[model samples]
Target: MNMLNVSSNAFMIAFFLYCGAFIVHAIAVMGRKFSNREPEAHVKKWGRFGLILTLIGLGSQLVYFFTRWAGSGHIPVSNMYEFMTFLSMMVIVAFAILYMIYKTSLLGLFALPITIILMAYAAVFPQEVQPLVPSLKSIWLNIHVTLAALGESFFAVGFAAGLMYLLRTVKFDSSAKVDKRQQKWLEFTLVVIIIVIGFIGTVFAFRASGYEAVFVQQQVTDVDTGGTNDSKIEKVIYHMPPLVAPHNSDTESYTSFLGMKEPLFEAPSWMNGVNAGRKLNTVLWSVISGLLLYGVLRLIIRKPLSRALSPYLADIDPDDLDEISYRAIAIGFPIFTLGALIFAMIWAEIAWGRFWGWDPKEVWALITWLYYSAYLHLRLSKGWQGRNSAWLAVLGFLIVMFTLVGVNLIIAGLHSYAGTE
Candidate 1:
């Protein structure tokens, strides 16, 4: 097989390996209650097995990265699929390093699933190798993207550790106002994560069923030389049924879903984005599917998810969890500053002749940086630790994610080129 084929096969292998590792880690954490098994020994033995599997998966993914780079004749970080996969790989690297340091099975229980979700999310985007656009042709593309993703990966690990700390410590049945509020917000955070997983599931379901819809939007542009408007028609395609149609557009083709042949609503005239309507429809479906999934899980568990999982983590030390979360973010923060801000500005100067344009993506990146900066300040100087620090770590990752995904979907700017078509 060709290197590209080899890369694809290797990627699949890595994904399966990661999945296996997650399952084994789950067993390691949860199987302690089984008959005749000492909890500590069971955890250590199975955690070692899980760690071995994870390392092998990481190695296989590295092969996928290099082979794809070889086959594509450029770095594979040019598009969403490649970048997300690379980010997932880096997350595994970070997780493994933390695992070695802490030797905590609970960390793997959270981290491996996240890595799996990222890999799956990457699959939701187009994976075909595409040539680098003019702006992405610099060596800084390699430096900026890899470093940014690497830093983000450490943040991901921080998020996992922080979340673990919360789950281990949060009082699910508390009657106090402070405790109740934390419960509600933690539940909301879990719901949001489920919603993301729902998005992946919804996309894959319709895509597998061969569902299709198409719209043609006519956009009028102002001309500088001529005293007239120039009209351009853009064709937008959806892999799922549309609940929201594009503004000022006619349906070129559409498939009925649940007896609905037309869009439920039109996108607002002001909502001019790259496939804004389709994206909005996707958001709607994700919310619906995610809620449904959460509901199903709730039914199965018959308790708050936090409560259901908290017992497994009872043996874990909350202070250690807090320390892991803080250390990961502390390591990630400076790297993020260097990559997402410093190298990014240098790249922008070279490509756009300006260092900072206040573009939506750039603005959000700045927002993320400032948010994390505040997080560190509060953590070190203002004495924010334990629950407060965990909350910041969790929320900080959310901001990072919004900067990565939400801005690309909702806003139109110079960085829109980085988004999927």
Candidate 2:
């Protein structure tokens, strides 16, 4: 069989393995009857085993992705199927990173199963190879998409950790109850993971693929002063024209217009005469600013601020979880900015001859970016720490998730790459 078929099969097997691992992890969480002492050595062994299995499953997934990339001859992110696969792999990688810091295998017990569901959803989409269009052939495509995926993956981890933080903070009856809460945390983590994954997966798999190219042609008569009616032909352009391959006969026209004809809708007033490249650079700088903000936070944490501050600030060190979540967002916010805003704008400029058109997807992306920016600002300026900041982290992720998936499926717009129809 060819590489895509082989990769698809491998992904299917990995999906099942993830499901089985999720189940075993759940059982381990449920079987814990007491938390009076550290979990029994055997229970720890089981947890370790589950984590190892999850890692193996994730490794297999990576192989499948690389093989598919080799077969497809482009980054596996042009369409919904490939993008969903990328998102799933990203979630696993993010979870692994968090596990390294906290050494909490419990998170993966939940995260892996959620990853499985996403891969399963991805399976339903068409995995057929589609050549990369001229517009997608850019170095920016690699930098913009890969970084965005990495940043979003970290946000995914923050979301899981935030949920766990919420669960951990809530008051429980006994240590056993806390153990039960941990199990609940596992379940909640899985749900959040799936929700984020499913949102992206469903849009690409079902909605983006289903988008239809619509065209309308009209004939009108132009009024003439000399009592003559001049017949005029007008083409009501609504959707982007079909992309032509570089080596194809139509390559001249395709390259001349930069791979697309015109906007489906009239350019919005706000976007009139704006420089697309400048807008892209602005968004890139915003992402860099976010990263710098995270660095400042890290530096602050490294110093002994407790000596200069009040007793309360000293007592509650907002250094550990808060810093981690902040750094994750700082790094991710820019990537999200690049993918959902910058590259998207570049695509819009090429396809529609304008950028920042306030399409539903575009609007939601701005909203997502602003929401996280607020989270960082509030956390830093207002001293929003621990649970409060973590909750905001969770909300920020939800907004990003909506921008990634919900906007494409629930709202109609020019960005239809996520649909399967």
RMSD of each: 1.8, 15.5
**What's the lDDT for candidate 2?**
0.59
Residue-wise C-alpha lDDT for candidate 2, range 350-406, written one tens digit per residue: 666887788886787778778887887897899888878777877777776677665
TM-score of each: 0.96, 0.60
Residue range with the least summed lDDT across 10 consecutive positions in model 2: 244-253
Residue-level lDDT tens digits of model 1 in 1-421: 3999999999999999999999999889888777375778998899899999999999999999999999998898888789889999999988988888887887888888889999999899888888888999999999998999988999999999999999999988789999999988999999999999999999999999999999999887778767788889999898989999988999999899999979999999877753888888889999999999999999999988877878888777899999999988888889989999999999999999999999998999899889989999998999999999999999999998888777766777777655365
What TM-score does prediction 2 earn? 0.60
> Model 1 scores what on Cα lDDT?
0.90
The models' CA-based lDDT, in order, is 0.90, 0.59
Displacement of residue 400 (Cα, Å) in model 1 is 0.7
